[model samples]
Target: MASVTYDRTSCVYPGAERPAVDELDLQVEDGEFLVLVGPSGCGKSTSLRMLAGLEDVTEGRILIGDRDVTGVPPKDRDIAMVFQNYALYPHMTVADNMGFALKIAGLNKSEISSRVHEAATLLDLEPYLDRKPKALSGGQRQRVAMGRAIVRQPQVFCMDEPLSNLDAKLRVQTRTQIAQLQRRLGVTTVYVTHDQVEAMTMGDRVCVLKDGLLMQVGKPRELYDRPSNVFVAGFIGSPAMNLFTLPVVDGGVAFGDVVHPVARDVLGRAGNSSVVLGVRPEDLELAEHGPAVEVDVVEELGADAYVYGRTKLGDGEHQITARVDGRRPPGKGEVLHVAPRAGHVHLFDVGTGERLGG
Candidate 1:
């Protein structure tokens, strides 16, 4: 396996004012599973396509290990891609589909057969080797796609939202399988998806991007615990972080009648009269007295529940979300006091959105 690098690489579609993938510089260590995540219209997929040689680089270079492969053909890049649609041949059996790459590369029938069987066994698709794509379940078809990638034994694997077609339960299951299999094979892999939860669970490191620019790159917990900016703070969590641009007061920012305390040194760095305060849903808890929140909806999810409500913070009312015990959630229209847990608040510059303080 080889490490992958994007050295200030960029891609611009003709006639477009801005680049699809702006200058991106990233390093994926050998055998590392790196995930690129962002919202729709973000450049995650374009960056992947540039590496796969399907898109032209308007500037800079891409490297696989020590080799510069910016202009290399896709077939010569020593990479395999698993697309979201499970691009399998309708007429081909699972075995043939898995071995097709080997056969095309001029491997003998015996070699191709051996490799196919090995991959199928690893993916638990041996029983369906003779079955066509149409006969397989969605998860089974995905396995076949994976088996096809595995048999090639490429230096790097590129998967573009490979599990998007599956149902929610199967998506979770297949992602686990894929992560385990990637670890077992020890091949460098780069995966692209719009799902932050999937990226958090599957990737060794995740790259968050927006509008062709890299936002943050870190281990899942790092990004979750210490986001670099407001965008990341708001995006990385399942129930997105609640952000309020409130007036900076003597002790802290104003949250209606309450004050969410902040270190003087932290507020000093804001450079503005107001600061953006972020708090995750889990960080906000029902308290005896804090900001009064009128509960609007409660989403009960067995062990936990999310309470979405409106509260007065600063000069106006705004929405807030809090995670509470599912069995004891407050009903709609119920007024409850919700406060940010100690040391759980995130502060950012009101204008620039950059993080402030430790």
Candidate 2:
């Protein structure tokens, strides 16, 4: 296992007006599972490709365990990559596929067989050792791809959306398996995906990126609880946080008829008559007198329900979402009053979209 470092690393493709991965600086601890996540065209994949030595570092250096490898070739980087499509050779049996790297490295047949069997057992693919890739299910093929990397014992693992090919249910199951497998192997891993839930659940620390720039890196809960900006506030959560610009009045921002109190410093930082207020769906409650909203839809999820509504705040209408008890959700078109829980509101500068305070 080894630590990886990106020292102001950057990648600019030919003729591109801007860098695909801008001067990114990140440190991955030994044996840590770090996930790079963002929307499509956000440079997450380009960053991963840079680490794998597939893309050139245009402005800075990358280090693996104190060794500067910015100019190293892909095969010489001592890293294993699991592609999104599970690039397995169709004609090769599972055992052969897993041990192919070792065979190429000139390891004897006996040693390669031993290593292949060990990885298969760890991945629960021992029964399918003789089967070809065409005979395996998507999930099974993914595991075979994983076993291929495991058998090599590479210093770092680079997995680029390895679960994108699986069904939803299998994707969830395989993510759990991969997380556990990474923990057991203790290999430094960098995973790239567009799914925030997968990043939150599988990574020891998640890195959020946008437009080739790093947004924030933190534990899943930290990112969800205290986003650094409005973009992050709306991007990290399921159903997302409801954000709307409201007039600042009496040291607070208006929420319909009521003024929600905010820190004086936060209000001062706004430097404007209005500020954006963000509230998570689960952090809101039905109140007798609060923001009046016309319900558009209610999604009932067994123990909890989310109410999507539109409310006229200030001079314009804005959409709002709130979580309510699942047992009794208000009917469509029903008017409901909801308020964000005290001390749970997020304040952002309307002009800059930056967070004001905690």
Candidate 3:
């Protein structure tokens, strides 16, 4: 319903030396689902709080559609937020809790009832309208919280880790439901979570942040394929991208006795500077003859198996990790040859952590 914009917005916690969020600029399109993702203490939550008017903006402006709402009170901003904890009125019935805001805003009884029923039906909670929060399951309680926001039909919807309390199976189920609901309602939504998988699966666009600074913003596949830096590369992938700080010698890099060929274009940028090589576990496959990897453990995960091991490269260092595919995985203490898939390697400048070659 509305496009949200943060124009150089920033926030500093009282008495803190550094700002919690620094000059953060972002744009969320109308009816777009934008996700903010980062590790703990990465300021993702602070940025969301600022947008919700729960935190003071020390600089810049936040705009909803074309209106500057930096100085506006939260209640007047036409935005509804669903918190991680189900902040429901324990004493009120489900229907009353959903319609309480409308009642407070002086909507007529008929209108309130209609809106409540509409939201309840959409969330499949019509059967439990008279039930209290104490009687509902955790997932049902979360739905009630969502029902409260849906009835308002606000310009923007903000969710702060709204599914964190649910069990893993319930979380996955609710995730699909929420995504479908957002698309059906076509409401502009901003969601904040630390889970990369959640951000990747649910967002129309994802903003990756660290230390209060925006790192990269893009569609899920784009970030996965072409992360701007080492942090983004490692953080966005499951099992994380394996990063090796290796020396570039001649036109190739030495991984023990095996001197894998590097693209001339990639090597030209090295120029005696230390380079970082990043390879996803999926990218490195078992080779007939390649760099030797010292196997540590093998895990059989039904559909796939992970070969955990250390590399016999350079000083014969040991690092623990899992290799996919159990059928042909190397046994413990066995040395297996590994090679990166063509065009699947990621190279970065060690000093800057900037991507050099795809």
Give the residue spans of candidate 1 off by over 4 A: none
Candidate 3 structure, TM-score to reference: 0.95
Clashing pairs in 2: none
Q: How many residue pairs clash in each candidate?
A: 0, 0, 3
Question: Of 2 and 3, which scores higher on lDDT?
Answer: 2
Question: Which 10-residue window in model 3 sums to the lowest lDDT?
Answer: 313-322
* Candidate 3 backbone collisions, by pair: 305-325, 306-323, 307-323
Please provide, for model 1 over 190-295, each residue's C-alpha lDDT reduced to its tens digit, 9 standing for 90 to 100: 9999999999999999999999999999999999999999999989988899998889999887766678888999999988999998999999877887889999
RMSD of each: 1.2, 1.1, 1.7
Better of 1 and 3 by TM-score: 1
* Shift in Å, residue 20, candidate 3: 0.9
Runs of candidate 3 exceeding 4 Å displacement? 268-272, 314-322
- What lDDT, from 0 to 1, does candidate 2 have? 0.93
Candidate 2 wrongly placed segments (more than 4 Å): none
Query: lDDT for each of the candidates?
Result: 0.93, 0.93, 0.88
